[model samples]
Target: MKQLYISFILLSLSFSNSYAYQNKTTKAVDKIVVTKKTQPTKTPIKISNAIIANFVNKYPNLKTYRSDLNNLYLKRNYKSIWFGGKGLIEFANLLYAKTNELEQEGLQSKFAYKNKINSIFTEKTTKNLASVDTELLLSAMYLFYAQKVYKGIESDKIKEIGWLIPQKNLSYATLLSYLLVDPKALDKNDTAQFNQYYKLREVLKKYRKIEQNGGWNKIVRDTLVFELKPGDSSQTIGQIRQRLATTGDLHSDSKSNRYDQELIDGVINFKKRNGYNEDPVITFSQISRMNIPIENYIKTIMVNMERCRWIDPEMTKAAQYIIVNIPSYKLFFVRNGKTELESNVFVGGTMNETVIFSGNINYMVFSPYWNIPTSIVQSEIKTALEQNKNYLVENEMESIKGRVRQKPGPKNPLGKVKFIFPNSNDIYLHGSPSKSLFQSEYRAYSHGCINVNKSEELAYLILKDNTEWPVERIKSAMEGGKEITCMLKEKLPVHMGYFTAWVSDSGEISFFNDIYERDDRLAEILFSEDYN
Candidate 1:
């Protein structure tokens, strides 16, 4: 009886302890629930139409985003997108990060309210989310980024700078939809912009870092010309070596102050890259050009990047295309995504700048007659006729349509052949009777047409696939002394563009003279405070 009594007591004591513990545990759980319920979490703000209207009216600079923002809100029924049921969307953070990296993306433009927009992230608060300012600012920034990166300068501004290529219009609605689906849409959709822009963007970063670290020393310009020759030692020689080393044109700075063989090779490389005819002696003009601040080169690179943005990326990837860069005075024949041939070319003079446009080369005229333009006839030929009555016969000239045209002969201005792309500009690629011009470094003496140094080789390449026109037949046609027009089996696209900075297939950066001074006008517009 005593054992049973003792066991019952222990069991009752255990049950009492267990009951108290259960009550304590239940109260702790309730406390946690209460705490969670009282926590001050951010409540998503309602994006009402009235609030949007008020914000839009207050921030007039963001007019570009107004229509798109309105459509976005109406579609979502006035719910905040950047800020959601959970503080902020992931895509909002992504867009913010991209805006911060505008410079690295080759954009020098600024957002008017960048600071205010950035503060939203730093001083993140529920109240900030409640208002529409943050969202509207983000919208504006997105437009600005898109404009500078994908769209480039405004259409009117491009037209003012004489860019005839069609401007690509990026749809904000489509971009937003893509972002909603994948916040990384911007980087993934790089194909929308020219690939060269990205390549140059990488190059730009290196140049920018170099600029920050203090660019190359300016070469002396007071001297008439740098009479630099191998084995010549002088103060100017030392400066030249230093300049070349700074630009990576020379392997290293020997500090010897001697114009050695290494310096000669370096000068040749520099001259070739700068569109100069390679020469043994460095000229005064070359020294003056080297003296130009590296900052100017940076600006040129930026300007060409803007040009790259203007191009259609797909056009560059065509199976066969001919691209003529007027500023560089070079022509590239690209086939199957590789540069098959490059030729030195003569473009227009300053007064007769080549037009920036694209055309399809479908015809070739062998032994083409040089029908002198009316402008040339009036300005030059008429006076020559008065000076020499027999000048017509002397030049193998005849009258047709009240205009003088050189007959098909060795003396004809259009040597051997010409490739025609029908256009209103009346420009065509042809061989020049002044073949000596091909040897000159600065060969921009033509009226407006382009003269190919290797015109015969170009003809052979163009008609290579056609068994009917072999090299012999082509040569025969060119020398037949009659104007013969033949249509191509396939029309090749030819793009005549003006770019002062270019990157070759081997990743060498080449700079050319801005013959028409187009870069200055573009820089003015690009650096304007009012630029959008």
Candidate 2:
């Protein structure tokens, strides 16, 4: 009995010690005491559930949401606590969608999470939401969503793939290449399309890098020695060196008359191959073409290309259309994809910069009356009247309710027929009596109106095919001294644009002076470190 009691007590003591240890272990595991450094608390944004629901409905594909998404975006409340995080996530998601790669899912998710956490800090939100960067991000997001929705239901893979292409880079060459090739062999499955899309993404990425590094902007000026035969080198080389030295091509051995003509000839041959004028005298322009920085040139191209994409692509295919390159001060009229008419135009000056826009030409006015803009009346007429009372009469001007107007005549400020496109700016394309102004490189003299030299011929050409009236009839109508609105059978599209630098149809890159100083301003805004 004593032995039994001692053994029972020993067993009970062992059980009690084991239970005590187990209890301690349970306490340690159950009550995890993590002491994190206290962070500044953010005030939660007050947003309406209705607004949240509406936003979700509008952007149904946007999977993630935050309380501040509505407040920050819809309400434009930058002070919202969750603004930064939500915006970042949205931006990251947008970029990921644009990549169209399944492999990027992991990275996209990580960014999305980081973006959410960063929003808690008010300081970060304020910094990121500065300028129009947020607007651009939102625009990109919307575009990506639209693309995805469009692609989802598309049955034709080639057609869908073609639609997926960024229209900004759809040059004549690229378009021709795509149009010529059949995308039937290319994979139509989502995975395959995604892979191909990634390949294009990679190409665009490398191209972007090359463009950013000024690869296209570098101009290498050299003279072409067309006199050289394929195998024969000496005479061709001598001619090249002579021309290089004369034209001041860089690296010309001034001392050595007997220079490497072969190298010079090779460069000339290369220039000829690249679609440049085969001139023996290499000018600065020629050199610029050779060594042009790709990034700078590409940016210029891309900007204009974006402008092109903004317009309906079908407009480009019209049988007849007019385009006024604002920066170049040139007008191009294309008929069935062929340039039928090309002319120099005088656009608005620096202070009164011509707007970049696209509009439809509704009618052409024969012997149109010049309705002076109110701004012109206030600035020019008022000042002219102050200088001389007889100024209006001397200039063949008529007074109409405290406003001066010019009568339509050869000597009138507006030469003849005016192509009127109703716009808020009260600007139009008209013939100019002062045709000499068009010859000037810096032609910005008009009061926010475009002056076309061959307006009559242009009008006749535009109306000839579609209208019943012959050129003689149109001339007679103008000669009758009456303003008649000739309605076009087919309303043509007009694109007035500003592009300081552009690649010509011949593939020669050309740069023009930013007469309105717009290019510099845009460049500063686009490429500046603090712009974002």
Candidate 3:
């Protein structure tokens, strides 16, 4: 009986000890899960279904980002991303810093829910971990930034301004994938936006700094066309030197009230940059442009930077292409990244603003006929015919298929040749009879088409590769006294755009007249929030 009691007591003690150890082990497991909730670990914590559901309900417009976020968490089983035991994740901090400096990236919009993301750091404590929603918020803001900066303003918004170059489509999901592997790719992946946009951003910073530092003095408008020859002494000369020096057109301001050779050279450089006739004389018209405030220049740079963001950098890398800047009244022919030829061009008049678009030039016509549009016929030609019965005979025009068209001759408005790029706008690049307009500083005198100053030369260069159209044949056809059309062996792309401010490949900046007054309309939209 004594042996049986001792054995029962021993067995009871063993049972109690085993139960206590099991209870302790369960508590230890619970503690491990609780600790991991505040820090990153190999094991992940389950986020409440309510957190994601609530975020989705609140920000329905972020459906794409929300879907991405759900997939991201689904892959990791809903573990925290923007939070760890130390508090906010390193990537979250880096992205926040970058978002705060949006202006440096040529962006002016406010980040959504910025304060809430910031509060994660500001309100963090030893007892409190980051909110479950913090990761979603950061991810959402990142998507917004990527869309705005990389994709630029929506296609419809740019189409309102007649830009139809087909904005490049970007994938934010790809960006997220990169960040998943290497978070630092946010800084390294510059291909998201056009390379020119970043270049313009650097220039924007410099212009803004200049504006902040009191900028250049506005030249007092004078009625007299000041033609300051060398050795001419006047207070206006000193002021001109000072103004040019501010823009780096002059190395230094001599401060001597004389038109020294240095001032003359500076004027020529200024004229060339501004698309003037390259004459050393400073006319009243030129001075009027010079008096424009530096703040306006800064605004021009900003607006043009926005325009740059809309371009696809890859388009600039085409094997052969032609680009025309309406404001600058210039055309560039590029092949294999080298400028083959440049020509002075005349864009549309203010009343008939030239469209901004791209097309492929597939054919050329030598000694083309000017087919007068029905609108001009009903409006102006009818009146001219009423005044003079022999108007068609005098103008070398004849009725062809019930339409009055000018014959292909020397007197025809389309001088000798025309390049055809099919578009709905009926716009073509052609030579003009009024060659004197090319010599002028401002050449916005066209009805709607572009007038190429070197059309014959452009034709020769474009067709030189084909044995069918040799240089002699091209020249002979241009002056052959009859209309001849030649289809190109290979089509070339042509892009017509409006840029009031342009930064060249060599980093030289040039300003052009806003002939169509587009800058103000675009500025109104860009700075709409500020005005409000």
Candidate 4:
């Protein structure tokens, strides 16, 4: 009985020693979550849920994020994510730097409690471990930065600025967990964001670098010089060469005043990218275009990046879709992840601006009679009849049930074919009888519907897989004697968008005229938070 009692005591002592030594020898990184005041030497890296609740109460600036803060801590079981046992974690420094550099994400302002947050990082005023204020402030700043960069301005505000594209539903609180695990996720262009956003981000960095390098000087046009062409020599030509070189349009700057073949090639390339007629002549107007300040370009980039954030990143994965960019006056047809065709298009006039929205191409109408809208019939047709009694006869138009209808022929404005999409706006894509307007750089003469330059080609591309409507059949249907409608096997998605700045797959950055003047309105909301 004495030996048995001794053995039992030894077994109990061994169990006690093993239990005591398990977590004691582990490092802080091994997640030895100690409660506050439990260990004198180690400041607890985890705190009570009440700590977050009380911290947000003291900081009214973070009051907007009270629920988000609570939800984050609750998910982590009240662990201090930004703080390790010794000091601030590595992600804390990265996140602080990102908050300070908000301009990279197109934000002009910092978090409201920036000064208080800075005190935690500065050596002179560094806080002790388990700093609740620092912990909570970093949490709030992370939300702000994540919302600005990953999600962008609020959905309603972007809608107020006439952005009809669908907005993303991002959970910044959930994203915090990823950053806690891997800090590098802070800068990675995750698939969650639109692909265009990353492309624009890269371009913004490149343009800012150019701005820091003194930008380009203004070219002075002399009274003696009217137009500059190849073989022409002037100081303005030298300035143009330097400007193109700075923008990566020209291979190199020779610093020569004489306009050579190299300068001519650069001029054409610049004009092509800038939505202008590709002409070698460098006129006064061209000089003005080249002289727009670099700062404006940077803001333009920022504005477009915000637009990219509003779109679903996975939108481009469609098997086939059509995208019409209003500002660029172009249409792109993509199939199997490749752009099959690109065509010039003319949008609505100022009086009847095209709506920024999306739809599905339901069917195609061949040699269809133009059913003129009531407003156009009253305003335009009546006025034409008042001026000339033979207007209807000359135009091959007839009045039908109080509405005028144009006969499908050479006289019709909607030439041979039109693509119809169901929308309340009564907008559709059609060919133009007068092709002269398509050749113009500023082709916004349409009443409302888009006038496609290559409407027949578009039809063929859309009906390529059908095998029912070959090229010859399509041609016969467009003969204007009878109207015919062909429904698509599957509806093709169509997105009418406006982007002033666009980056092609080849990294070619192009800027077009903001036809609706929308960039400023959005940029104001993004920078000023006027939506609040």
Query: Which candidate achieves the best TM-score against the true structure?
Result: 4
Top candidate on lDDT is 4
Q: What is candidate 4's TM-score against the reference?
A: 0.86
- TM-score, model 2 to reference: 0.51
Instruction: Estimate TM-scores for all models.
Output: 0.85, 0.51, 0.83, 0.86
Please write out the lDDT profile of model 1 over residues 153-210, one tens digit for every residue: 7788788878886556567666676767875566646657777777777778778887
Candidate 3 at residue 398, lDDT?
93
Worst 10 residues of 2 by lDDT: 102-111
| Candidate 3 wrongly placed segments (more than 4 Å) | 1-53, 56-91, 120-131, 176-190, 221-227, 530-532
Worst 10 residues of 4 by lDDT: 29-38
Error of 4 at 163 (Å): 1.3
Model 1 lDDT vs. the true structure?
Answer: 0.78
* Candidate 4 residue-wise lDDT, 5-36, digit = tens: 99999999998885554334222211332122
lDDT of 3 by residue, 316-392 (tens): 87899999999999999998989999999988898877889999998999989999999989998999999999999
